[model samples]
Target: MQLIIFKDYNALSQQAANEIISLVKHKPDAVLCLPSGSTPLLTCQLLVQKAKAENVDFSSCTFIGLDEWVGIPPDNEGSCAFFFRNEVFKHLHFSASHIHLFNALSENLAQECAAMDSVIFENGGIDLMLVGVGMNGHIGFNEPGISFDLYSHIAPLDETTTAVGQKYFKEATELSQGITLGLKHLLESKKVLLLANGNKKAAIIQKALEGEITNALPASIIRQHSNSIVMIDEEAAVMLT
Candidate 1:
């Protein structure tokens, strides 16, 4: 695991984008596990700009969503699919057929979870996974106490997670659970890029990187992975030293 602290968000985003572009260039068909939410917004924009300027081809790349809020329709503005369509797919050269998204509303959630895990396993696992640490140290919707052995599954959202996520929707939305590609899958990736920013994330970031490994702080499990890069802005790294 490597921790990289940047002076600001722009620097962090650019570096992260460059790393992703490099991986894609090296392996055009690389399977990527992508994250949702505000943390990766700038990184996605930087990727769009870089791809356009460099004429990078992402048509052969495969993108898999990290997680999705249970019961949220794809058309919902706060949905993970909606975020990918607006923030990622719309900005890249990727083919629609190459994108694999989670079905949050499936009547058979267990089967859906198994299907997601099978896809990743059959595709030779993820080559790269872009992730963001939650303020409470959760990764993907895998909240505190979630077992590290689990793969893709439905996870109950922590109260803290739901409260923080409510800001993304215009109206009051009840988000009780999420379908997430688990830590086992994320750690199986050939490389993982974990991102965090803002002063609000400082203390948690410090604990996740420097503290003991524990399921209570889900992101700390990244330490067990052979190849993991943690990128944070100055404010988020304030507690590091």
Candidate 2:
């Protein structure tokens, strides 16, 4: 794992966006797994701007959502699908066939998990996975105590995750479970970029980076990935040793 501390959020977002742009430019058919949240909002915006300014082509790239809140419709403002649709997909004009996202409302969720895994496998695994670390040190809804051995699966949301996730919605929404690509996918990805920002994330970022490697802190498992980068702003890196 490599660690990079940026001067501020904007710098961190730029670096993240640049890395993605470079990846697509080098490998037009790169398969990506991306997270949705406040931390990645600026990064996604930057990607759109840079894609246009630099003439980067993303039409051939494949996108896979990292996770989604169960029982929510994709069109719901709070859903991960909605976040990507407005932020990256529409802005970049990504081909519909190149996008694969979890159907949170699917009645057969296990089948949804299988389909996700199948897609990842068929695409030759994820070329790059960009994720945001949750306040609780969770990555892609692989909350505390989640086994790193698992692939795509339905996860029971931790209380901390359920509570913090409310900020995504305008009105109160029930957030109990999440269908997500698991830690195993993170490990298997050819490259991984983990982003975090704000003072609120400092302590958890410290724990995930400087503390023991354990499933209790799911982000810590990134330490074992052959190629992973943990990038954070000064505020989020404050607690790091």
Best by TM-score: 2
Candidate 2: worst-modelled 10 consecutive residues by lDDT: 132-141
Tell me the spans in candidate 1 whose CA falls farther than 4 Å from its real position: none
**Tens digits of per-residue lDDT for model 1 on 162-196?**
99999889899999999999999877899999999
Query: Clashes in model 2: which pairs?
Result: none
Q: Determine which window of 10 residues in candidate 1 has minimal summed lDDT.
A: 90-99
Error of 2 at 206 (Å): 1.0
* Steric collisions counted per model: 0, 0
lDDT value, candidate 2, whole model: 0.94
Q: lDDT per residue, candidate 2, 1-241, as tens digits?
A: 9999999999999999999999999999999889998999999999999999999989999999999999999889999999999999888978999999999999999999999999999999999999988878899989999999999999999999999999999999998999999999999999999999899999999898889999999999989998999999999988887
In angstroms, the error of model 2 at 41 is 0.4
